[model samples]
Target: MPLSAWRLRLLIVSLLTVSFLGALDHTVVATSLATITGELGAVEQMSWVIVSYTLASTVLLPVLGKLADLVGARLVFLSSLALFVVASLFCGLAQDITQLAIARVAQGVGSAGLHLMPQTIVGEVTSPRERPKVMSWIGAAFPIAILVGPIAGGLITDAWGWRWIFWINIPVGMIALALAVIAVPHIAGRSGRRFDIVGALVLGVTVTAFVFAASWASAGTPGTGIPLLIAAVVAIVGLAAFIAIELRVSEPVVPLRHFANRTILVCIVLSTVIGVGLFSVVSYVPTYIQMAYGVSATVSGLVPIATVFGMLVSTLVTGSLASRSGHYRAFPIFGTAAAAIGLFLMALLPPGMPLWVPMLAMGLVGIGTGAYMNIIVAVAQSAAPRTDTGSVTATISLVRQVGSTTATAIVGGLIGVGVTAGLPASLDASTLTPQAVAASSAAVQAQVAELYSSVLAPIFIGLALAYAVGIVAALLLPHGRLSDELEPQPVVGAENAAETATA
Candidate 1:
């Protein structure tokens, strides 16, 4: 029987709240990171804020998705909501950067469940035909989040303080929890098989080893290279172990067998590459604007709207065209090229350029990134067996997370190296807050912009080159039609969803 209107409303509220919070945290800290690091006095470890949240959440995506499948999303979502609320309290009370990073990691564990389970919950409960309304609201959260997260982070940091950005989740999470208990029906577990604890542990350790190594090296701490080398060896060993474990396990985190399909392999490669640059922009750009252009956190928050807007338009229009035509290859092809151009523009941007210049550049990037946002996942799902649909979806998410992990490590290292070498002792990472930059004379501001441009130029160019590689992968992707009957839950993950809806 269909849920009554009242129950349905409560259910949708819970789902949207869960999704929005997950999505919000992804970008919300972008504007707040500088201030957080500044206040906490750890300039070199600044990327940990984004790195920890993203890395923790990223590695756990597949594991959590599978757990939801095995145990039921309702149980998982409630547990995750409770964890998220408590972790937020920890984040608010954190006494140091390390403490905050640790809290964010715990928070990310909850976010992993909160992010993926909503769609799963709704899928388990609702009739397929009735989903679009709920799904659209869920889909709407991505765009709204990208808009609100940074702006709200900036405002909250400027006013009550950055800790409130986290503490704020407490009330919201509690409300969602109440509404969910009142409305969402219990979904019994789908399978009685043992959970893949080994697979999950192996995957998590491998990623953490790799990210820690990269982040440590990026910090430029003396005498740490040996430890970095050790982390690298551990990552290699852990990856081997993970592969071995997966091949032997009954239910793998990501089945190695799926790579046998040519289309599946191509889809994974393309998704991984696009994902490398897709989310990292939000991680660093606002901080870049604040540090380089002397913009207030509020204005910095507003900048990503250009990229999100571009992605939104491109996703909607291209999704519609591909749906009607069933020709899905062009979006990735053209979209990647456009993103490359946008990055090129950003890389070559003159110091002291007008705000609109970067805005325009990011818009092109959005246009480009939006092209492949949802289509790639739809194609992958179509190519996989229906029985393995959810796992396949989660695996794709895992690899994309891997890609972002790579981006953050390499890019974060580059920034750390640049700041250590190029920036003078007078302008420590903590000292480069918006207030400090704003107080500087025009000549000093221009000088800092030039220094920032030089440091950031290669990173943008390098990301552009990454997109160029994605274009090559997209070209190699077989000319396949997107499935008419896609899994009702999004495989695009919670990052962006409505693109598939337009189809």
Candidate 2:
């Protein structure tokens, strides 16, 4: 029987809740990092707290997605939520950074499942025609979480404590768990396919090495270049091995044939490009605002809310339009172009422009990004064979995460080099905080602003270039209406028999 309307709505709400909680974890913890490190007395190892979760989550994404395909999404989703709740409890209770980091690893495992399974379930439940609308709701969770998390984190951390950041998840997790248990149906996979353990290992190693290299590069601590280089080599070798193994495996964790599909490949590329642009802006723009305008951290943090608001509006509008028209290629094409224009406009902003200028530019970028947020995933799932849905979805997630990490590393390098070049010999780059900028003489402030603008211009230009690449990819996307029917799995026996008959 088809799912009832009310049931479908309930299921979506449940999934969105899971998605929000998973997405919120990173931003909230990031905002509370200082407090966390201070209370735990592990300020020197602060990066590990965030890095550990990111590495674990990135490594486990495909593994958990494969597990969902093997066992069942309902089982996986519920179990992950339970694990997240338990991990959150431990995180809140931790007396030291080591324990907190360990707990975060567990949380990352849950987060991986939470992030991957909900979208997979959305694909399972909705017809391609309706998927855009449903997926828009799901996709909106991340930006909403991004918008709310920092402010909430600051408030909660200030009023209560950093532990409350983790503690807050417990209630949300419980609610999502209850709703999921009631609303989500069990989605069973083929029983005969063997798990590809070797492929999983290789892929994990490749992702870990790549992520470690990017993290080190972004950290830019002196003497880390050699380690980064070594990681890059390992990542290259591991990725080659992974591809080789996947090609030979009967049932691979990631189906090699998906890459052979031009449409799928293009969608993946677009996803990565969008990820780079979106996350780069989200991660660094606030810092840019603080430095350029000498605003309080709170005010600068609030500036990104305009972007998130724009995203929310565009997501709903474009998603509905795409679903109604049963076409999606236009969304990405137009969206990417809009994003590129916005980014270019941002790059061109002169120092001491009106405050609304950057915020408006960010809003434009958000609108462009939002238009394709869930549409690309819907398109990829629609294009792939039913048997490969989980794998395709996981691959999209993996590529996007890698893109975000890569963008962060690239932007960090650009800023680091630019600051080093622009700052005078007498000025220590470490002392160039917003507070310091505010305290400096008028001449000093003007000089710093000019230097900052010069550095930021290139970063924004780079962002525009990424979106421009996305625009090309989007233009190249195959024009096909979303099929009303669910994707069909291939029949191995029938294919073999047909081949024999032809011979």
Model 2 Cα lDDT, one tens digit per residue, 1-503? 45789999999989998999999999999989999999899999998899888878888888777777777677888998999999999999999999999999999989988899888888777777778898898888888888888888999999999999999999989988999999998787766779899999998888888877887877677899899999999999998999899889888888877676666777899889877997755777777887777677877766588888888999999999988988888999989999899899988988777778888998999899899978888787777666666777888888888888777877887787787778855467876677877877877777777888889998889889999999899988777777665543332322231122111
Clashes in model 1: which pairs?
none
Q: What pairs collide in candidate 2?
A: none
Model 2: lowest-lDDT 10 consecutive positions? 494-503
Query: Distance from true position, residue 246, model 1, in Å?
Result: 0.8
Candidate No. with top lDDT: 2
> How do the predictions measure up, each by TM-score?
0.80, 0.94
lDDT for residue 493 in candidate 1, whole number 0-100: 31
Off by over 4 Å in 2: 217-220, 487-503
Once fitted onto the true fold, the runs of candidate 1 whose alpha carbons sit more than 4 angstroms away are 1-14, 26-52, 89-103, 119-139, 154-164, 178-190, 287-302, 319-327, 419-447, 484-503
Candidate 1 at 94: error in angstroms? 6.3
Please give the CA lDDT of all the candidate structures.
0.75, 0.83
